[model samples]
Structures are given as C-alpha cells and as structure tokens.
Target: MRRSILSAVTISSLVFALGACTPKPDQADNAAESFLESLSSHAEPGEFTDNPDQAQEEINSSWDSLQAEGLNTSLNNVRTNGNVATADFTMDWDLPGDRNFQYQSQMTLTKTQDDWTVRWQPTVMHPDLGANQHLELRTVPAEMATVVGSDGAALLQPGTRYRVFVDTSTGDLQSTMRQVAIELDAMRANDESVPSIDAEAKAKEAEQVDGEFSLLTLNQQQGLDLKNRMSRVEGLRFNEEQAMVRPDPNFAPDIMSRVSSVVEKDLEGSNGWKVVAATSEGSEVRELGGQDAQTAPSVDVSLSKKVQDAAQAAVDTRSDAKVMMVVMQPSTGGILAVAQTQKADEDGDAALMGQYPPGSTFKILTAFAGMQNQGLTPDSIVGCPGTQDIGGRIVANYNNFSLGNTALENAFAKSCNTTFAQVSTDLQPGQLQQTAKQFGLGVDFNIEGLDTITGSVPRGDVMLERTEAGYGQGLDLASPFGMAMVASTAASGRMPTPYLIGGPEHRTEAQGEDGNQLPKEQLDNLRRIMRSVVTSGSGSGVASAGEVYAKTGEAEINGGSHSWLTGYRGDLAFATLIVLGGGSEHATSVTNTFFQNLDGK
Candidate 1:
C-alpha cells in the first residue's frame, strides 16, 4: 500500500514538471506583442526585453524611418523549439493617401529567467538592415503653381529670365564694376523696395571668382534694356534661366509677394504634399518610396487689368509726391486696382497701410451721422459761419470761406466746417462712431493675402472733439482703401465688403449687425449731397465725367496737406491720395486726369 501511494505521487510530480518546462503559445505571443506595442507607442521596452535601454535606443533610431501614419502588427504561425521560440509576424504600414505597405518579419523570443523575452536585433525591423545603416529622407521639388486673374488669364507664368554676370578675367575691373552697379541702380530707381547693390561687394566677389561671377537677376524686359547698355561695356555676360514672370513687373507686386515658390521650404515635411524618399546612407541601398508631389493650385484674384493699367499710368507719371489710387467695383466689391508711385517719403503699401486725417472727405460719415441721429435732411436749415470756437480751439473751413445760413445739402456740398461742427454738438456720445461703423469705417477687414488699415474713429468725449470729428479732423484717420469703401457704401446702399480673393466667400463681416447695411433713404440723401459736390462744390473739376458723385479733402500735416478725393464714376468707386500735395485742388486735378484717362479721353 505504501509503494502504490509513492508511485502515484511521483507520477503527479513528473506531470507538473513537464507543464513548467513548456510555455503556452499564448505566453510567447503576448511577449512578442508587448514588445511591438512598446515600440509603436514610443514606450520603454523594459517589460519584454533583456536590455531595455539599448532596445529603446534602437527603436528611437528606426521608428521615423518607417514613415507611416500607423503600424499594425500581428503574430501568426508561432512555434516554439526547446529554449528558442519563433513567430512569423506580419507588419502593415498605413501610409498617406489610403495606401498600405506590408512585409513579413520573423520574431525570435528566448526563454530567460523562466520568462519569454524578444531578442533585440536591427534585423527585427527588416531582414536586410545592418548595424550602421540608417534610413534617410529626401524631398523632390513639385511643379510650380500659377497665379490667375479673374479673367481666367495667367497672371504669373513660367518664363526665361537672365542673371547678369561679370568675367573677372577681362576688362577694367574697378571702373566696369562700379558702372554696372550704377546702371542697375538707375534701372531700379522707380522701385524703392529694390536694394541698392554694393560696388565694394561686387569687387570682392569678382576677386574670389576665376571665370564668371553673378551680379543680379533681371526680368526679360529689364535684361533687354540693360543688355544693349552693357554690351558696349566690357566683362559683362548674361546667363538665362527659367523663372516666374508676370505680364507687368510692377503688377500688384505686394499681393504676388505672398505666393509660395515651387521649391518651398514650408512644404518639406508635409506628407502627400511633398515627395519623400527613404534611402540608406552607408550601405548605398535606396528605395524610391513616397506619393508624387502635388502642384499647388493657382489663385484667382479680382483685379481688373484695364483699370489697373490706367491707374498705374496715372500714378507712374508723378515723381514728386507719394500717390496711391484704389479702385473698386461698387456692386461686387471687387478691388479693381491698387496703384502707387515712387516718392521720397514712400514707406510701404500706403493705399492700405497709411493713416492720415480724412479732412473734409470724412464729412461723408459726419453727414451720415447727422442724418441718422440729428433728424437732419438735405433740405434742413443750418448756420454756416466763416469760423467757430469750441474748448478754446478755433475751427474754420478751407480758407475760412462759408455760406451763412444755408441748407444742409449746401453745407455738405460746400464742405462747410462750421455748419457741420455746430451740428456735431447736438449728437449723442458715440453717435459719430456708430455712424462711421455703418459706413464701413473703423471696421476690421480680413482680405486673404492682403493687409489693410480700415480707418479709425475713436469715441468723442468733449464738445470740441465731437465737433472736430464732424468735419473729418482731430483724431479721425483713414486709408485710401478705407475711404474707397465709404464711397462704395453710399453708391450701393448696402456697404459692400471689399475682397481681392475668393470673392463673396472671403467677405469680412461688419463689427456689429447694425453696421452691415445702411438705410436706403440715408444713402439716397448722401448720394444727392455727394453729387452736388461734383456739380457745384470743390470736386467740380471732375464734372466732365458726367453726373459724378465726389468729395475732396485737404488733410493738414506737419509740412503740407495730404490731398484726398473719393468718388464713384459709373460702376466704379475710387479713392485717390496725394501725400503732401498742396490741398484738395491737387487731388481734384489728379481725379480729373484719372477720369479722363479712364474714359480713354
């Protein structure tokens, strides 16, 4: 009986030992899965590896090389032999563009300390990978995108341009180099944005080169102009290459400057947008892998070529003072033209960026405010004295000329400072600001690929400040573009949101819902007053354009006056600013000329 009991115990102990010697398939599969999970999640590999730190370093180096959005791995056909175990695992990489890349890799797990652990090796990622070899990424440049106009014409096109080079081996080195620099400066004198070349730097560059040294790249027209002049001069050569070109070199350079280049640095790591290739550096093993780079789509703008050319010609003729002219279509709010001339005081895009008092031009908003808040009409009687005083400050009309006791229409038409100033005292606080907002003044704009300053009308506290605000002075400031919209609002009844790109989709909403649209009655009265300005007031000079509505301003500054004229001719609403160009008379003359040229007269 003792021998039989001992045999049973021995048999049971042997069965338990056999179970301990062999690990279940689930245990080996779980261990392999744990290692892959750690790698995919960028977690420490200590739980499933012999050397956790080394395994982590290996994973860190090879992870980005995969270049995948997601990695899905599964263990299949797992088998174990003695202390060594093997599993055939399939790895599926979710790349960009709904594409998938898959490969089969064998995982080797060793039994250590009675636990299954994956043996770390570079070959675990790919069978061909070596210890020193690492994956490298390369980018291929995509095709360039074109900028198109509203007419569906290519605004910018790929064309040949020339870069001027100097042969250091020939000619008078010092004299020729200096003359070349002078000629380049003369060519670019009209554009203040162009940087002047340094003659000393050119000389140094010439010394460093044995054969040919490049100076500057120029457009076809620019190169052609310089080629003839430089042909007679020695050591000059022209190297031609393909580049982006516009129909007119100065055609909206500010707006086009924001367009992306073909070889853009910003698109380097953007998946699917750029072509990415994986390569092995040391082993000379390379695989061409990545989605083909997509060309950037062209942008269509609302600029009118006819209007832009005319405006450019008018502004380009002047070299005396800074001039900016902005034209917009009242019905559609499409910006037709933005033209500026080179000047001594020119800083930036003055059409959208400059801030100056609107002078009498701001009276449009003042007159609107009076109509909205003061129950005043075109026929309302108002006193227009030559001068008036408020808070110890004297306000006078242009040259102190005023028609005493005239209708409000005449006061607005004649731009009587005293009449408007006196009426302003009756306005409630914030009345002028509310009126300005209704006219699209002091409203923020978000035109794509463009920056604009849309006038500023601060709240008037005292009687004097409110009175000044009435006549477009004393803390009232606006841009030519902003004033253009003010004229457009009066023309269209509803204040049209100005846009250069994407049309109505890019229209900027007004600050307040009340300011979005004006009453038709108010706009009608405003139109009558503006028309009188052209027919009988300061803007009579532009009357030849036939039934024109206009307002003229002479904004006072340190040295002189900034002449401003804003009006609409037919479907076009426009604003013109001549920086420090005498008074409204100068702006009036420019306006007349602009209209005549616009009509092809």
Candidate 2:
C-alpha cells in the first residue's frame, strides 16, 4: 500500500509540472501575425480576437474614415507575461495623392486555455485613440490667384461660372429653339465677345442625341440673367463651378487660350489636410495631424490690358482681309499684345504662328548681311534696275520699278528688289541665315505661356534660291511674332530674350542660341536706313505716328500678295500682316491706327 501510494504521488507530481511549462516562442508570434493580417485585410478578426465584433468594427471604421487606398501591417516585437502578452505592431495607411501615414502601437492578447486571442481596445488601433474615439481625414480648400497684366491689373481673374446645359430629348427641343436663340442673342449683345449661337442649328444637330448637350457657360451675373430669362424653359440644367476667365474676352483671345493651359495648375495653391480623432457624428474630438492650406500667389504676365484693347480695336477695323499683329516691349522683349481680325481668327493663331512669305521684309535681313559681311554701308552706292537676271532668275521690283544706281539707304527705302537680290546672291552660302539669327529670326523661343516660332532661313547654298530668298519670296517664311522680334532687335541693337511670364526667376534662354548683341555702329546705321522708309519711302503712311522707323514688304504669291510692316516707335516694336491684302500701304495704315489708338488712351 505504501509503495503504490508513493508511485501515484510521484507520477501525479510529474504530470502537473509538465502541464505548467512555459509556452512555445512561436505561439504568441503566430497569434500576433494572424491578428495583423486580419486587420490589414480589413476582415473580421474571427478566432484571433477576444471580441471579434469590436475588432472588426474598428478596423472597418478606420479604413473608411481615413479614406485609405490600402493598408499594410507588420508584427514588430512581442513580450509574453504568463497568459497575457503585449505585441508591438505597425500599421501603414496609404492615402490619396500618394500620401502615407505609419504608426507603431501595442496590442494586448490573453491566453485562454491553449489559444491566445487579441483584446478589444481603441488603443490597439492607434496609441492616441481613446474610448469611443473615431479616426477621420479632413481637407481644406485653397484660394486660387489671379493673373495680372502689365498694367498690374487682373487679366485672368477667378470667377464663379455655370455651365448651362439642356437635355435635348427631355422637352420640345424644336419648339424651344427660338426662345433659346433669343436668350443667347441677348448674351451676345451684352458681351460682344461671347460667341454667337445658332439655336436652330443646335436643335437640328441634337435630333438623334438622347443625352445632355452643353450650350454655353456664363459668369455669375450673366448666369443670373440667363436664369431669369430661362426660368421656365424645360430640359435646362446648370453646373455651378469656379474657374479662371478673362474679363474682356476680346483681349488677345488666341494668347489667352494658350496662357490658360500653362498657368492653370499654378493658380491653385497648396491644399491643407488633417488627420483627427472624431466622434460617431463625424465631429472633431481631438487633433491628430495635418498641415494648413497655403494661398497661391498672384501670377504676373507680360501683357498690357490697355495696349491689348487698343490693338484689338485697331485690328477690328479691317474686315476684308485676314489681318494680324504682334507687339512687344523693345527694352524688355515682353509681349504686350496679340491682335487678329475676324478673318485672321478663322485661320488660327496667325498673329503669332502663321508662316508666310515675308516679301520686301526679307530685304531687311539682306541689308543687314550686306553691312555685316559685304562691307556695304548706308552711304554706299548700289545699282537698282527695273529687272535684273541673276543665277538665271529674273528678279524685279513691284511693277518693274527702277532707281538706277542710288545710295544704299535710298535703295532700301524704295524696296529695290534687284538691288537686294544682287546683294543676297553675292553672299556666301551661310552668311544670310547667320545674319537672320542676330536679329531674332530663324530661332525658337520656349516662352512660358506663349507658343511661338521665329522665322526660318534655310541655307542659301543654291544661287537661284538665295536670290529669291534675299527678296523675301522663294524659301522664306515668317510669322508676325518672328518679324516683331526682328523689329525689337533693331530697336535695341541686340536680341532681347522674349518671355510671357514676368518674374525674376521665370526668365529663360531661347532655343538655337547664338551671339546675343550686334555691332552698335552697324545697328545704328540700320536704324537710320529704317527711318528713311517712314520719312520718305514705302512706309510713309505711318510717318505721322512720330519717328516710326520701319520696313514695308509685299510678298508675291500665285494669285495675290501679302502686305507686311515691321518697325518701332519709342519702346514699342511691332509686326503687322494682311493676308492677300495687296500693297504695303495697307499694313502701314493698320500700324498707324494701332499707334494712334494707343495714344488716344
């Protein structure tokens, strides 16, 4: 009996000791990994959690409130104290706009029999969270800045807009056409820049369209007026919004379109955001983290509202031809205005982009080449015949005009085609093209907010082509913007880097770089030669507008001619073109009106 009792006691004691041994190291680690995986997956923490419902609720709430695109979690370090364990974990929340938020916190788990389960607690999600606390992400909007012009006045201002629409299939589309047309006509009358709409045409086009069709967008006051006018009109709808708009739509329409795209993002400043602890009602309970919104600064552009208005008015005077103009500040190379008549607008950005034969204007470059490469001065005598044969090509002045043997300045003023043709054909292959670059032609400018191409002068290796190019006909092509640069160069005696964005830091070098400044003696002589054109020659039409030094050109095409005038007065340099508008006098007349309008202001 004693022996049996001793054996039972010893076996029972041994079994008890084995049952109370320390837990396996991988036991708590596996449980922590399982809980983290569930939380990161936004799934229910079924077996690994003590209170599965609470754990699942908190996980889902956090994911939604934080607007997390994705969540990743990891088990950091675990410490076991008998049946209770503390596991350090990290949660990485991926937010919108490529933002990320990461935090390290501890989760509590208790061993129940053979299994370890996570405990339900707000601190398990975030160390800063309290009981019944919720997580939230908040955003603050930023105010956009206005674009200012050279006059330091708002050019493109932030304004309230309403994009008005109509469901063509919802109402009597055909019957309502007249009223809509009347309303649009009223808008046009109020703001002539507002495009005219054809209601009947729109109705006809919407015949097969069963969806919404946008009619027009109006400003706050204009929208109010429209609402009052179309209050009872069925199928009418509006989308309220904010955007940048030109106060005077007639002011440099082409340039405004180009500038809007480049400056749109820059106008909206930094937006503020915050992560906060909130209540069930979505109100802030405690501060978590975030940055305040920063207001965007004003954007200054290299344009003058006053100058633009004048230029637009001047260009509008011509309706029979496609007329365009580009004006720049000679001293700074800042664009002042771009203006185009109705016909020119139809051709798309011709004021700064249309490439055409530049006629007598090519003589300007040829004459410069003569001075720079051929040792010809303004006082040198050059021959001018009614018609001259060079390189087997016959070059003649307009109507075969002739000025037999005259001073270089006189020949230039008279626009003697033969004289310039001879000079151009006599030069080395690359001489003319190189000289053109010195005057801002044949180069490219990556001007912020402006898309422009300086004129092109091909290698004049072939004598016949060079002869024709010298007279501004054969392979020569230039836009109004290019000619403006040339005029500005002559005005300042060096090529000024042109820019649309005005600031100390935004200035940049133009493409196809080369020598910047030209010889002062030659430029001075060139200036004198240009002045003679206005005082007594082809450009005399604009002579009343002060000492307007200029060059007049008439490019001959198959059926007609293109008129051109490029020059400067005071600090304003400009170029004017009239497509198929015969005679340089028309261009000179247009230029005179532009200057006069500026003065009248």
Candidate 3:
C-alpha cells in the first residue's frame, strides 16, 4: 500500500512538472531582446547629444582611450537574427607583461533604432583600464522564479524566506557551471553565509566542495528535508515551479563586502591578519568563526525621496551656484538617500565627511563633562565676566554675553564662553579625553565610501587650554560623520552602531580580546546631559525638531566658515555641517535649510 501511494505521488508530480516547464530558450531569448529594445527607447542617450557625427566621434574616442592601454579589443563578427544581434570579439589579454591568449566573447546586442546596445548583461571591464573587454548578453527569463515579499518586493525585508533548488543540467555546461561555482565560492567566503539548497547532489559526490560546507547540501537528504519543510507551509511554494535557490544578485555585492570591512577596521592586527574574508553591511561587520558580532548596525543617513524632491526644488530656486543637501535617519544610523544638483560636484556630503572646527558646539561637550566630573547639576551656579584668563589665554564669551553670577544651565543657554572655560579648569585632562572618547571622538568608526576625521584633543598640560577646547576652540576638528556618532550615542543611551545596509543576521562566536561593552551608566550620563543641551542650551536656536537634544557650533578656521549642528532623536543621531566657500552666510543658510526640512519620523 505504501509503495502504491509513493508511485502514485511520484507519477502525479512528474505529470504536473512536465506541464509547467519554463519557456523554451528561443522564446526566452525573443522576450529578452524585446525588453532590451524597449529599454533602449528610454536610455537617456547618456552623454550622447543631437549631433550624430559628434556621438560617433565620442564612441571612437572612448575606444581609442581603451586601445592606449595594454589590453586590446577588436570587433571580429556581428550578426543580427531578428532583435538578437550577436557580436564576437577578441581581447589581447596580457597581465603584467606576460603574453596571455586573447579571449573571444559572444555578445548579444539588441538594436533599438540605429544604435545596437548590449542590454541586461554583465559588462566586464578591466579594472585598471576601465575598458569593456567582453559582455555575455543574455535575457534573464521573465519566468525566472524569484523570492519576493508578500507585497512582491525583493526578499530583503525581515522575516522573508527564499526557496533554493539545484539544476542538474547545469553540470553538463562545464564553463557555465564552473563560473557559477566560482562566484558562489567567493560569496560564501564571507562570514555571513547565505544558506544554500543543493544538499541532495552533495551526498552522492565524493569530492569536497570549495565553498561553505555548512550552507550547501545534497538533493536527496537535504532536499527532502527542505521540501518537507516547505510543503508543510501554506502559500510558500513558487507561484510557478522548480525555482532554484540562488543568491539574489542585489544582496550579493553588499554581503561580499560587509564582513571584510569589519575585519579591516576592528580586528586588524590580531586574528584579522589571518581572516580570509569578512562581511560588513556598511559598518557592522559579521565576524566568522564565532568572533565578536557588532552590537548595532552602521549608520545610513541619506535623503528620503520626499526630501530629495524638496532639495531639488531648493536647487531650482537658485541659478548661479550649486545646491547640496543630505537627509539622515537619526535612529539606526541609516542614510536614506543622497541627492544633489549637477552644479555641486561635492554635494552636501561635505556636510558629513568634511572636517571643521566645532566652534560653540564644543561647549555642550564641555559643560556636560564639567557638570558630570564636578558632581554639579545643570543648575549649579558659576560666575561669568566679559572675559577671563585661563592657561594664560584670554577667552571672551560669544559676543561677550555676561550673565554675571548664574547657574551652569543658564550660563550654557546664554552661550557664555567665560563660564564654560572657567568650569573646564576644574576637570582634569584625562576626564575630558574619556568624555570625548565616549562620544566616538578620537576613534575610527568605519563608514564605507566616506573618510572620517577624528577631532583633536589635547595630550597633556593643555587641561587649562582644554577648557577652551570645550567651547569649540583649540584643535578640535570633526567631520559630519563624527558629530552624528556623538549625537546618536547621546540619543540611543548608548553608541548605536552606524550602518548603511541591513539584514543577514550577525552571529558572534566569541568575544574579542578587549571584551568591551559600552557601559550602561556612562551612556545614561551622556543622554541626560545631551537632552538638557537641546531643551535649554545654546542649541535651542535650532530646536524646532520637537523635543530634540542638540548642540550648535560656529567655528572660525582662519578665514574659512564652518558651522555645525549635532543632535539626537530617540535612537537616531545626526550631524549637519555647512561650510562656506565664501562667507558665514553660506554656513548659516545651509543650517537654516537643514533645520527647515527636519520633520522627524
């Protein structure tokens, strides 16, 4: 009876599979060519213009530039069968002067109007020369089974599981199979192993595979387990059928770099030297072999689409100069999007990566540290004259604002530099450094694609001079990224790890040699003080973000204009920097634009 049931089920499944097979290769190719033609119609011509002769010349110039390099590419054959245009080309492949054989590439070009373009293909360009030597242009079948969320988005959001299958026919195509295996091997080298679904084939093979053994499996045993797991679930099967589990390409690039970045930054000297691969989604590194996992995701702060629209509008309002804008999610440290006009080559990224003097923003850190070290509340009274001498240097309050004798909180609100400098005299040098370090100063928080500058702090007897450093003076240089770290640390009640990408859970196998965790009480102290700075401090000028904690700075760097605003909202921390290429108005206007757009989520 059992044998009868198994046979019946197997026969029924085979009949169904035969009926639902994917489209024929020729049909798939036709569909892909048609899609490419449609895409070419909207392809923006890139840098191409109305002048046909100029466009052709530009293409020749681009090719000439490639020829100047050691690698050579020549078009040998071109054939068009309907929309499918195939081009065979050879490249003179010589690596580091050794004579290597030229390779042939078969390219399918979809003709849209007069120009034949390679579409939906991986364009391989030599890294040093920046020349496209070959392209394997093929249409990805529309029926290709892909995992999507309930809403049909990519399987990127949380709680989404993907299906995996191994195509037995792939083994027959040696070149394609080997290439696929190589790519998968490179991906699995990362600590965050993407799970695979080819267990059944593995059980029969005698030789060991190169990639993540823990992830891939054979079809019989593992496939049965996986199939059973999926069969038990309702609505989890592919909308079609026989969809194989492959690493989604979109996530592959991010996952490949995610772990490596962490190992490069945090674990550099020790076992990091031995690390073959690492994974970092922006900043948080997924350590392999049970190493220390990141406590938080890296900060990804970019303009939302709505804000980008607003920023474009703002740029349109201006004609002569460029407009640069940045938007950041204070919570989770994720940069949403970065948008800018063509005029500004730098973009408002200078606001984040550019280093500048802190000016008065330093007062917030100073006052917080002084108050904390002295065991003095914000209301603790301190005297302030128009000017005071500290470490043989005379410091005057901003605009010489004198509060006579007043509480520290009132002094802070008034932006009285004299009171702050005097208060700094009480705290030792070690105390101030410790305070700054807590705010992620003087330490590298690895942000991919951006350079970070750790603002300066005095080494020794500058403790008297250190008071001025508190008021955004005396060698304190910081980037927008650094300030955001300070604010996020203040907001999260701990330093939340800043990152750009998310997902693929981090597994910590073991703690590092330094076994360090951000102390709870220290984070609390930062929160309390930073909260006060926003509610009733000099930063109140920019406190329109509704119950936000912030600090503002206007630094004088010789002749350059640098203004700063750093703040935190809930778990989100951000810093906005405005640098004036001309004057202070540049800084102030940028700041105003930033605050004007700060409608928090």
TM-score top scorer: 2
Question: Of 1 and 2, which scores higher on lDDT?
Answer: 2
Tens digit per residue, CA lDDT, model 3, 1-601:
1111010000011111344566433332343333223222322222222333433343333223222223344545555587666655554422221323344544455655654455322222222122222211111122222232212334221122333333433233233234334444544455234334233444334134332222233222334444454453322222222322323332223222443343233222222111111111112122111122222222222224344444344433433454333434545555432333445444534544556677766666676677567776666778888888877888887577677998766676556778877777678776766666666665555554334354655642666567767677777777666666666656654444544433323221211112134455544554555566657765655455556676666676676556556665554455555454343234334444544554532
The parts of candidate 2 lying over 4 Å away from their true place are 1-138, 167-169, 173-182, 195-216, 273-292, 399-401, 448-450, 502-511
Clashes of each: 0, 0, 37
Local accuracy by lDDT, each model: 0.74, 0.83, 0.46
Q: What is the lDDT of residue 228 in candidate 2?
A: 85
Instruction: State residue 165's C-alpha deviation in candidate 3, in Å.
Output: 38
> What TM-score would candidate 1 get against the native?
0.65
Q: Tell how far residue 5 is off in model 2, in angstroms.
A: 58
Off by over 4 Å in 3: 1-331, 337-349, 503-537, 540-543, 581-601
Ranking by lDDT: 2, 1, 3
Q: Could you tell me the lDDT of residue 448 within candidate 3?
A: 48
Worst 10 residues of 2 by lDDT: 5-14
Better of 1 and 3 by TM-score: 1
